[model samples]
Target: LVKPIELWTGKQLFSVLLRPHANMRVYVNLTVREKNYSKSGETMCPNDGFVYFRNSELICGQLGKATLGNGNKDGLYSILLRDYNAYAAAACMNKLAKLSARWIGNHGFSIGIDDVQPGGRLNENKRARILEGYGKCDELIQSYNKGMLKLQPGCDAAPTLEAHISSFLNNTRETPAKVCMEELHWRNSPLTMSQCGSKGSPIN
Candidate 1:
């Protein structure tokens, strides 16, 4: 069976490996022959490069229609992280969560180690430094734990960023669904890496 095309003019090559009277494997490879030109007879190199979904969910939706359970779980993260530079990854992590003092430094930014762990909580000094770099206030991070961060009037709920993640954690029994999956050590999950990046890359 052939895979569905997603509006690409490239030549796609597919190959399948099958054993006699046994299971089979199907693989589809897509490669662009050349740039698609415009009506002016000039080669038009698209600035967008290729047409692809932004996230893993969209890619899974497309592949699942043709073949069930074809896409990998962290494929999206792999792609995004591969393209991200060091600066981009650090910015993304900061916006996602107030780094628990443990994940500071090493991103071309100097941070005091005295305020990122259990014994080294985010004190006023470290908090100021992080806030200055990330453009976020320390009060905002504190609001996450306290019952202060509100969305609408009279509604005591976490901020949009925090709430979005908390909802996913609740669904998965407090275990992270995607990014933090490897970092967390569950019942059977062994301690593997020290700290994984937001885009599924290793941090140090």
Candidate 2:
């Protein structure tokens, strides 16, 4: 049976958590500080920050910032948030693995772990091209964004921009327009292929 734990808030909880105990006195007090982006008074910009953790036993740190790209325009902030979340998750998994290793022999339990890589940086040239392509299709993009505003989480909606491009290309038999649509589709697709055709020729 577990004893009832006292609940405290704000300064009371802080004092309780921070105060040293008789058996194991606090040896270090580590605080992970993050910059407050609200103080900057900027709009539609990435909030850069750092994270660090230190205890009596170990210290680990990381610094990162958000990125904006055509790849995930819907959830731009998630690009950076995912990295920090992955780092925290990895740290927790490491601690769990160590604990599991100690209990393996006696408890007949083992743990397996997988690798986690950080997100890739957006390529400047590719980004520029994607932006240029979007610039050409401003009306389409605006319509797509408006449609997206109406979509709910589980709505059975078709691929917005891809479908639009496909229809546009089908309707317009112009070779140059078809090439532009193909380039846009290729840029947005998950497959890693060159934006250009054979021998580095421009799509146009």
Query: Model 2, range 1-204, lDDT digits (tens) per residue?
Result: 124866432222222232224454333323222222323423322322222223322122211121112333222123223534544434433554565476565665222231111122323444555665566467666767677523435543346565665666444334443344334432232111122111122222
How many clashing pairs in candidate 1?
Answer: 1
Model 2 scores a TM of 0.16
Off by over 4 Å in 2: 1-21, 33-97, 100-136, 140-204
- The C-alpha local distance difference test score for the whole of candidate 2 amounts to 0.35
Which candidate has the highest lDDT of all?
Answer: 2
Scored by Cα lDDT, where does model 1 land? 0.30
The lDDT of each candidate is 0.30, 0.35
Residue 87, candidate 2: alpha-carbon lDDT? 45
For TM-score, the strongest prediction is 1
**True-structure Cα RMSD, model 1:** 19.6
Q: TM-score of every model? A: 0.17, 0.16
1-204, model 1: which lDDT tens digit per residue? 145755633211101111112232211222111111112322232321222332211211111111211233233222334454444334433433443243344333332342122122323434444445344434555665675665755444655545544454344332222223332333211112111111122212
For candidate 2, the 10 contiguous residues with the lowest summed lDDT are: 190-199
- Candidate 1 residue runs with Cα over 4 Å from true position: 1-137, 141-154, 157-204
